[model samples]
Target: MPRAAIEANERMNLRVAAQQKATLMRAAALVHADLTEFVTRAALREAEAVIKSAERIEVSERDFLRILELLDNPPPPNEKLRAAIAALPRDR
Candidate 1:
């Protein structure tokens, strides 16, 4: 199945000093890239790290079956889980 395009809900607006901007331009010049290309490449590298850290782990076939078995017969809720749930902030 194909997935539909999804728009992001958040945006960031960064501010920097003139000196910093000059330094960035110089670095971009050294790399023969425009400011937009340099900024995008740097942002994309950080974004890749963020995405890798946030993703769920893939399991082996045997481990996946074990996970399914656990889901079929889930353990009773522990006190720690109950406390954690209570401590969590309510979503709007």
Candidate 2:
């Protein structure tokens, strides 16, 4: 696909060594996707995991207590959070 085919999403080029490229190409072909599509999907999957891990979440005593409380008596819905989740992509 060309630049014009891509939507208004943030994008950039990435590089890997020649040997790595050859290895990835073989893997991609085995899975029935071209090099570009294979690499892009793999990289973005890892990027999402990294972003999730970077979120500020701690497992301290207070956090554990809050979790126990929630498990004991779950809270009602927050409309804002529900709307945010509903807006996410369903195509996976």
Candidate 3:
């Protein structure tokens, strides 16, 4: 089944050097895509990559093992944690 086309109602404007604009137009023509479509597709691809990289956390194998070990052999809560927990309101 064919999908319905989405309407483009928003606008974004930017200024670039004439050479840069020409280069983008040339690349778009080589790919048989309209200038707006090509630029937006490339921008969106890069944006998604940037967002994924920012949201990802990388841990070393040694640190990961340490985390698992800590979880398995957790320490007893000390005075501060006990006081904080006790300070919470109790139900009637």
Best by TM-score: 3
Q: Write the per-residue lDDT of candidate 2 for residues 1-76, one digit (tens) a residue.
A: 1123665876666678999989999999999999889988998899778777777466999889999999999988
1-92 in candidate 3: lDDT tens per residue?
Answer: 23446659777788999999999999999999999999999999997897778788779999999989999998899999999999999995
Model 1, 1-92: lDDT tens digits are: 23446658644456889998899899999999998789889989997787777676878999999999999999888999999989999984
Off by over 4 Å in 3: 1-9, 78-92
Error of 3 at 31 (Å): 1.1
Q: After superposition, how far is residue 52 of candidate 3 from its true place, in Å?
A: 0.6
Highest lDDT: which candidate? Answer: 3
Candidate 2, residue 72: lDDT: 95
Candidates, ranked, TM-score? 3, 2, 1
What TM-score does model 3 achieve against the real structure? 0.63
- How many clashing residue pairs appear in each of the predictions shown? 0, 0, 0
Give all candidate RMSDs, comma-separated. 8.9, 12.4, 7.5
Query: Which residue runs of candidate 1 sit more than 4 Å off their true CA positions?
Result: 1-13, 56-92
TM-scores, each model vs. reference: 0.48, 0.51, 0.63
